[model samples]
Target chain A: MRRGVLAVYQVLLLVLLFAAWHVLVKLEVLSAFFFGEPLQVLARIWEWFASGRIYPHLGITLLETLLAFVIGTLAGLVVGLWLALSDTASRLLDPYIKAVNSMPRVILAPIFAVWFGLGIWSKVVLGVTLVFFIVFFSVYHGVREVSPVLLANARMLGASKRQLLRHVYLPSATAWVFASLHAAVGMAFVGAVIGEYLGSAKGVGYLILQAEGVFDVNTVFAGVLVLTLCALVLDWIVTLAERRLLRWRPAGPGAAQS
Target chain B: MSPQPALALHRVSCRFDARGGGTYVAIEDVSLSVAEGEFVAIVGPTGCGKSTLLNVAAGLLAPTAGAVRVFGEPLLGLNRRAGYLFQTDALLPWRSVRDNVRLGLELRGETDADRLADDWLARVGLGGHGHKYPHELSGGMRKRVALAQTLALDPKMLLMDEPFSALDVQTRALMENELLALWSQDRKSVLFVTHDLEEAISLSDRVVVLSAGPASRPVGEFAIDLPRPRDVSEIRLQPRFVELEQTIWQALKREVLRTYQRAEA
Candidate 1:
């Protein structure tokens, strides 16, 4: 019940901030050219939605983020489990893994663009690179963190090799995966937008770049607002999933109701 | 002739390559056995290789030397006929209490795994708490869940490493009583390792004392000759129980001091 009230206030705070922005611009306290007119921003967004012009761009950005997240998470889980479980493999590849992970992976965006061209694939690949490491490191530590006692207990309980992976290893690793889900999803979105901002045929990021070129502050703000909402939605979805999947986790950061 | 012992370790040893330098011999030439339906406890000072021996019995760790035999068969890999109760919180936190109990049965392809899990849960005095997760339960409750999880498998032997060491005096005694009640039912061979001499004497048919680390091994053994269905708390007040403790403590005291002096050094 208190949360229900707090949620209303949260929306109220957003409205009050936007109202202050509108009133400030109306009184000439802030320049509409730079700060942008909130009303016009909302109108532009409505216009884009009404004409359905924003759908394909929104679709492309959303698709890129999603594809990157799924593929990257899977690749990270498989590779992380393999390397972590195998003493020889992790030792041999240790330095190379460190080198690749430490290198500024964002710099690879241009190369991905060249390889995949100015399409959704380039952005998706960029997002995957960003998401993969975050998840890979989490899974690596997670698999290693499987309490030796617990593993031994499972083995003594007659769990086969395949059963160990499914029951003991996968569940343990997924806890670490859920802990990093928000950051991974956020990075995926960042990768897609940064990829698009650098050069792309369509995406909300592309629209913002186009608006900035002509100095149309209203469209730029609209695009920013749209992307912000999308990020919030994705985070909400991650929270929901973490709640359901990690229900057994002691309530703390990941499973916090608030 | 008598039947083969349920578990036997002849001249077993464990040596670890210390992170800093030379091999650390945790235990060496440790020979022990638990006859069929016997409950044996190994007690020693803290840091003694009591747990290492238990691990060897569970087949979780390979002995550096010598051999481990289960029912006259040379053991290999994981012990197929034993259930191990770890000292630490070893339950899978992600699974519900019932699911944790159900996992072993399901792995063996039991179609009625859920029913069996519920039966074991009820047997462990946790009949209504099956839906609860490990983290949601109190420490004692979690221990009960672990007990249920281990016992549900119906293993021929149990390898317990200070399983109740973490519980408070009250909970520990309660669990000890429950364990005795259950063990009396089937009388599975038990190899329990602990530092508490009282706990060992109260729970086992025989108590073995280990010397301090750096080649810890059995230094003494005593048969309790305690009667059946003994109450752990009540048995302690008996004159015979006191007699056994005094006898074992004399031999065990020197080893405890050795461990202390080694630590001080």
Candidate 2:
């Protein structure tokens, strides 16, 4: 019964927000040209789905995001583990790594376009750059933070160096990597959309860019709403995977009570 | 013919670089041995480097001086013939209870890892808890899983560093009795380290005491004449047990007091 009340309150909040948006636009407190009508934006989104006009664009964006996420995550895991285990190499490369990670990676989108020539590969490259650093740092710290006692115990139990890497280091890093994946996924989407917005023939970002050029505020809002929904869905999938993999963890207080 | 000691540390010393740019000796000239199938407990004041001595025997730390021998062979790298029960929670948090127990066998690439894990878990009295994770269990249960994990490989020697110090008194005694029962069956060499004098006397065939640290060494040793198949809780009531405790505490009290004075200074 409490959950039902919470659900009703949640829906009421969104309804109230949209109602306010509609009222302000109708009263001319906010310009319809700039903000767009709430009903019109919803209708535009509905029409795109009803006519299946958003499928191809959404598919392209999602494909780019997924490819970027997979390649970036794999590269980060391998490089993070390698660098973390090798002390001298990590020490030597420390400053360089910090410099590279600190740069505004969004600026790479235009350069990637120049190199990969406005194709899906350019967007994928940009997305990979955005996702890689988040995972890399997380995994690096994870491997370094492994409990020394646990390592010693494993060694005494006769674990070889290779076995230690596989059983101890990798699993410990995996937990940290999973924790960073939600942000990494969001970064991947941002990279792909920004790449498309800058210069692209396809993707939801391109559709929004086209609508903006023609002053179709409703279509632009519709495109943004669609991307937001897709990002939420992807994040939900990640949370589900995290739950399945991390069943060994004790549930937090909020989850335990529920 | 006499069998060689299961593990021997000869003139062992460990020095650490202090944060203040000077060297600090953790243990100095600490020689000890555990005979085959013998249970030897090392008792000392807190911060007396007892765990450091155990680490040396386990081959996890290389001594600044002296040598370690395992079954009359010079030890190298890790002590492959020994298992270590750490004081802290060393069980892999990502693995379930059964998987943690199977870790040693898995490292060796044994084919029957699952069966061995299940059998050892049952032996440790965690038969129905194989599926639960470490966080789901109580502190005593986690220690049992750690014990099972260490013993699953059937190592010839066990090196435990205050393994039950974190548990409550009742749980600690119960686990001690269980460990004694298991040790009686297998008869593996054990080097148990703890600050609790009663626990050392109750559980061990012999107790070795170390002096206060900066550079700690063995100050005294006593043979416990208690009979076999002893219950750790009930053993303390025996007159002989009390007498032994008194004798050992006389040597230990001085070092413990010296440590306290040093700390105060």
Candidate 3:
């Protein structure tokens, strides 16, 4: 009963905040042209949908984000596993990898545009670069942390190298990979949008950049809101995948949802 | 029992690099033989290399010197013949009870994996519980699954490193009985390691006692003439069981005192 009441209370708070914003705009205490009233923004969003101004942009951004996310995560996981399992590979590449990771990735946005042209490919390249390093570090650490005792036990049971990786190393790294994915999703969007801002003809980032150029603060805020909502949806999808994949994990840890 | 011992350890010694300074000797000049179907237990104070010997026998660790042979075959590079029941359950947390049992067979490329897993799970008294994960099971259940996994491989010998030391007294007794039943079906050569003298005495056919560190060796052995299909309650009452327990305890007590004296010096 208390949970239900809290849910209602949260909805009520959002409504009250919007009502106050609407009243402030009506009294001219807040400038409607600059900030826009809550009702005005809502009408603008509805107009966008009815006139088909939003779908193509939304589609382009979603496609770029997803393609980049898949490519980046897979590349990171495979290479990370290789480096961790091979002592020689890790020793040789350790310093170089760290140097690359520490360098600023955002500066590569304009370079990606020049390399891949002003298309969705440029944004994807930028997004993938951003998402790769986060997942690589997490997976590398996870594989290294596996207990030597457990490895010995598996060997005694006659597990080959490939079998050991499948049974022990992969499962150990899975949780870390899933955690990295949550953060990676946001960075993926940031990379794509920044790429679009620099050179793309479409996508949410381009819309925001155009709004900024015109000094239309209301449209700029709307673009920000749209991107935030999309990120939340992507995060929710990743969480669902995590729950399905990790069904074998025992309950009663800190895994229970609030 | 074969004329040749199921497992033979001849003048085996292992030296490991210690962090602080000089090299640390884990096991040295330890020589013993366990015959087929014979249950042998090694007891000593902590850090006496009892577990290290078990690891060598399981083919998980190489001895710095000497030979360990399983059924006359040198265990120099062999790892597929013996099964290991670890001190910790070591059950994969991501696999269900049934899947954990199937892991060994899956790695070995066995076709009838499910059928083999079911048989082992039933033997371990965990029959109707193939779906539960390790977290859902109690400590004893996890250990039982670990045992079942080892049994499924049909190993020629079993190397257990204090497999039940983590259980409560009552649960441990029950598991010991369960172990005896499993051993009775197809008597595999077992080299069980433990610090508990009474446990070593009640379960094993021969108890091999070890001395303290920096090069510990086999110090004593007792043959348990206790009858087969032994009842846990009756086994405790047997005159021979009590005598063997005391003998092993006495051997262990002396070694433990020496270890403390060496540490302080």
Candidate 4:
């Protein structure tokens, strides 16, 4: 099938890329000190995994990402529904919401560190701050833009206010949230890594920081490689969840399909 | 015959705030009624506020003036005894066909919702498609699901706004025949609105024509004396049916021309 052929080409491309990188470094065309040797990076990753030294760091990062993504999405959904349904509230909060969303939210990591210390909570809070806005805007638009005909139809079917919220608002709102799942998850991962780099003794970001202090470029490359794999795992998990939850959507190049 | 009508809109006037400062009148001083178990179709020119009248009857829109009564009682909130069929796709895209059909009953706290939903799906000839989503089905099939969703509630009255206008000619005729078959079982008082004069004449016991808008009102009314168990495609070939169409088209044609002329001006 076409999909099978495409997969083979994808794997071939990755191999070609790695092979070219290995050959360039061995020929001294590229500086190993700056780029780091591909063999050493791969070996370093293998050693860390073989020794099981990277498990705690990887686990902590994933935990923070999960907690932040869940809390942020839930908060966004509830607040979005409230604002969309209440015209007065939305109008009153419009300017303030825009101002806060436009601010450089990553700058809050230092403040969070001061309040929550160098624990996991500070990183989680930073991740939550990053993930919240993406979900909030999506849900808000989704709820506000719900087809009026559907609302009228549900009303005609004897739907009470509570029933309307349960049957109509939540489902539509979640579609928008799910559509933006990738961006939110990526933001959470970035928040956790950045928060760790600023002030934390744990997580892969901390390991990379420690490696950089000693000019251990190979170790730094190894740490980044490990972190990249972890992100891939998280993204894969998100894709699985989106598939199960959004199966009703048409099959296309978006969420809600295989 | 019962003296009280099933639905009565008395001197209803709906005026909307225009884009600028002044008010725009949609339907002005329009009064209409549908007797119990009667099928009444309201035909009009484009933008003649035909849907505004239907929305008022359904209690989805409150008229700027006058009142709406249902079976002798003044409607306060949503008309609880009426089901609405919208012109556009109204089925919840996320829900399966059976779940969409069960939505109303579930909202009402009915315990046997699944059984009733399945039964209604069967009635609409979509029994095997209960597991499919709205987008997975054809346009006509989705409309059938919407019909099942509305009919499962078993409301005393039905308010349909050009429910079959979106389907193709063949599918539209098939849906019409199915609708007639369902309505004949126990004639629910129906207020069907459309711009298709042929569709209006074919499906209803009576047809009311509204003039072009700015302030639209009913300009004509005609009784359809076509016999029961009629096939919508076959009925158009009959001489009586043609005569009725010509008579109604005369009343409707001037309003249609007025709408076009105003648009060009």
Candidate 5:
């Protein structure tokens, strides 16, 4: 009953906040340029959509995020596996990898922009850098923690090196990969947004930057809402893929009902 | 009754590098052999290097001294003659029952994995559970899947490390019976490792007792001579089974004490 009441309360709070927001703008408690009326923000979104001003920028940002996510994930998987499998490589490069992972990667946006230009490539490189280390560490830890007893059993059963990788290492690493991807999605967005913020001439981030330059706080908030919506949608797709791939996971309440 | 030895270990010794200067011996001066189609069990206290010996036989571990051979070939370079059944079922949690059974066959590049896996799973009384994953099965069922997998390859030799130790008493008995029946179909040479004296006595043609570590060596070998088809119910009843169990226990008891003493030291 408490949960049900809380759910209703959440919706009521949202409505109340929007009402208060519109009232403040109408009463002149907030400036139109800085806060804007809620109705105006909604009107601007529809206007941008109808004029097709939003589509091209949205498309570019989406493409950059998707490409960077895939490239970063694949590169992380391969390198992580290689490092985990080789004792000498893991030992030699572990400290350097740790140092690089620990550093603030967002600070490299200007450097990436200079290297790859104000195009989508610079955003992709930045996104991949951010996503790669999180996934690499997860996959490496997953593979390393594989049960020795299982490995011994496989060896006794005549498993080849290739077979061991497929049967054991891959399955073990899969959980870690999924966990990393949830974080990676947000990082991908950050990479593209930061890239546009630093230099790009066109992107949702570019639109947000333009609005901010003119002190248009309402438009800045509008860009944030758009990005958040896109991230949630992408995260839903990833969750679906995870469900299909990891069916071996014990049936949850969802499966029980089905 | 004349055939080559299925496996032979000559003065096998395994040593691990310790944190200190001295070496830690897992096994030392251990010589053993199993004849073709014979079921031999090795019993020892914990830390007696029984697993180390099995690994050496499977060609996974290299002995610091001496050599292991399977079917007249040195185990050092051999790839696939031995089948190892771990203490845990070690079934791939992500795979279905049939897939777990098909794993070894798939690794060996056998194209007929589907049909073979079906047959083996049926043989283990898991005919309709082919699509169910390991997490969906019970402990005994998981071990059955592991057994079916090992048997699917038709290995020349089977090395089991406490394969039934994880099961409940009733399940263990049933598993032992299933194993005996499977062995009867085509008696592959088996080297089973266990700490259970009765288990070692109940299933083996011969039982080898080993001393406790840092350097465990064979203490004695007892040949089980009760009867053929080795009646599980009758074998327990036999005076010989109890005699062999007691004898092996007597050999193992001192080693168990020594192992504990060493730990405290």
Candidate 6:
């Protein structure tokens, strides 16, 4: 009964928000040129889907996002584990890593375009840069923070160095990495969109850029709404994976049944 | 012919470099031995470095001075012949109860790891709890899983560092009785560390006491002559148990006081 009430309240909130937006535009309190009409934006969205013009661009954007996420996560996991285990190398590279991470990474899109020639690789490279550091730092801290008692117990049980890495370090790091999945995925999407906006002929981001050039406010809003929906779908998938993989964790407030 | 001691620490000393500067001595010139099939408990004040001594015997920490021998052989790296029960929750949180128990066997590449793990879990009174993760279990249940995890490999010796200190009194006594029953079956040489004098006196064949730390060493040792097949709870009511507790506590009290004063200072 409580959950039913909550669901009703959620739908009510969305309805109220859209009604306010429509009222403000109709009253001319907000300029239609800037905010766009709600009905027109919704119709524009319907037209794109009905005509199937959005599919190709959506597919390109998603492909870039996925490729970047996979490559960046793998690179981060390997380097994180390697540096965490090797004290000398981690110490030697400490200042250099910080320097690289601190520099604004979004600026690399133009550089990547120059090198990868405005193809999917440039966008993928940008996405990988954004996703890599988030995963790398989380994994490094995870491996480093494994309980000393657990390590000692494993050693006493006769775990070799390789076995320790496989059984203890990797599993522990995986849990931390999963905790950062939502943020990492979002970063991957940001990288793809920003790269496309800067220099690209394909992708949902490029479609939005084209609409903006013609001052087509309705199409621009439609593109943004589509991207938002896509991000929500991706986040839901990540949540499902997290729930399945982390069954060992105690149920948190979000999972609590009323 | 006399059999060799299962574990021997000769003149073991550990000094840590303090965070600010200089050095701090954890344990100094602490020599001890546990004979084959013997249950020895080291009782001391809180901060007297009892766990440090156990770490030395387990070969997890290299001593600043002296040597450790296992079964008359010089010890190096990890003490492969001994199983250790840590004071804290050391079971892998990501693993289920049975998987935690299976860790040692898996590491050893045993072909029948699952079967052995099930048998050990049953031995620890967690037969149907194999599927539950560590976070799903109670504190006592987690400790039982840790015990099963340690013993699954069938090591020749056991080194437990206050393994039941975190448990409630009732659970601690029950676990103590279960441990005694298990120890009686094969009689593996055991070195148990704790600050509880009654627990030490009730569960051990001999009790060794260490002085207050900065540099701590054994101050006294006593042999417990109580009969076997004893229940830890009932044993406490026995006259001999009370006498042994008093004698050991008398020696331990002075050090405890000294440690308290040092902490306040």
lDDT of 5 by residue, B2-29 (tens): 3668998999999999898888999999
Per-residue lDDT over A1-258 for candidate 6, one digit per residue giving the tens place of the 0 to 100 score: 598998899899988998999999999999999999889999988988999988999999999999998898888888899889999999999998899899899998999999998879999999999899889998988899999998998888889999999889998998888867778888999999999999999998899899899999988998888888888788788788777887788887844521
Off by over 4 Å in 5: A1-43, A251-258, B231-234
Clashing residue pairs in candidate 4 are none
TM for candidate 2 is 0.97
Docking class of 1: high
- Preferred candidate (DockQ higher): 4 or 5: 4
Candidates sorted by TM-score, best first: 6, 4, 2, 1, 3, 5
Model 1 Cα shift for residue A219 (angstroms)? 1.5
The alpha-carbon deviation from the true structure for residue B74 of candidate 2, after best TM-score superposition, in angstroms, is 1.2
Clashing pairs in 2: none
For each model in turn, which proportion of the native inter-chain contacts is also found? 0.92, 0.94, 0.75, 0.85, 0.69, 0.85
Candidate 3 clash pair list: none
* Tens digit per residue, CA lDDT, model 4, A51-128: 999899988988888899899888988998999999999999999999999999889899999999999999999998
What are the DockQ scores of the candidates, in order?
A: 0.86, 0.84, 0.67, 0.84, 0.60, 0.87
- TM-scores of all candidate predictions against the true structure: 0.95, 0.97, 0.94, 0.97, 0.91, 0.98
Mind giving the per-residue lDDT tens digits that candidate 6 earns over B141-251? Answer: 999999999889998999999999999999999999999999999999999999989999899999999999979999999999999988898889999888888888899
lDDT of 2 by residue, B82-129 (tens): 989999999999899999999989888899999999999999999999
Q: In model 4 chain A, which range of ten residues has the least summed lDDT?
A: A249-258
The better candidate by TM-score, 2 or 5, is: 2
The prediction achieving the highest TM-score against the true structure is: 6
lDDT per model, in order?
0.91, 0.92, 0.87, 0.91, 0.87, 0.91
True contacts kept of 5: 0.69
What are the runs in model 4 whose C-alpha is more than 4 Å off?
A255-258
- After superposition, the stretches of candidate 6 with alpha carbons farther than 4 Å from their true spots are A1-4, A254-258
Report how far residue B132 has shifted in candidate 5, in Å.
1.0
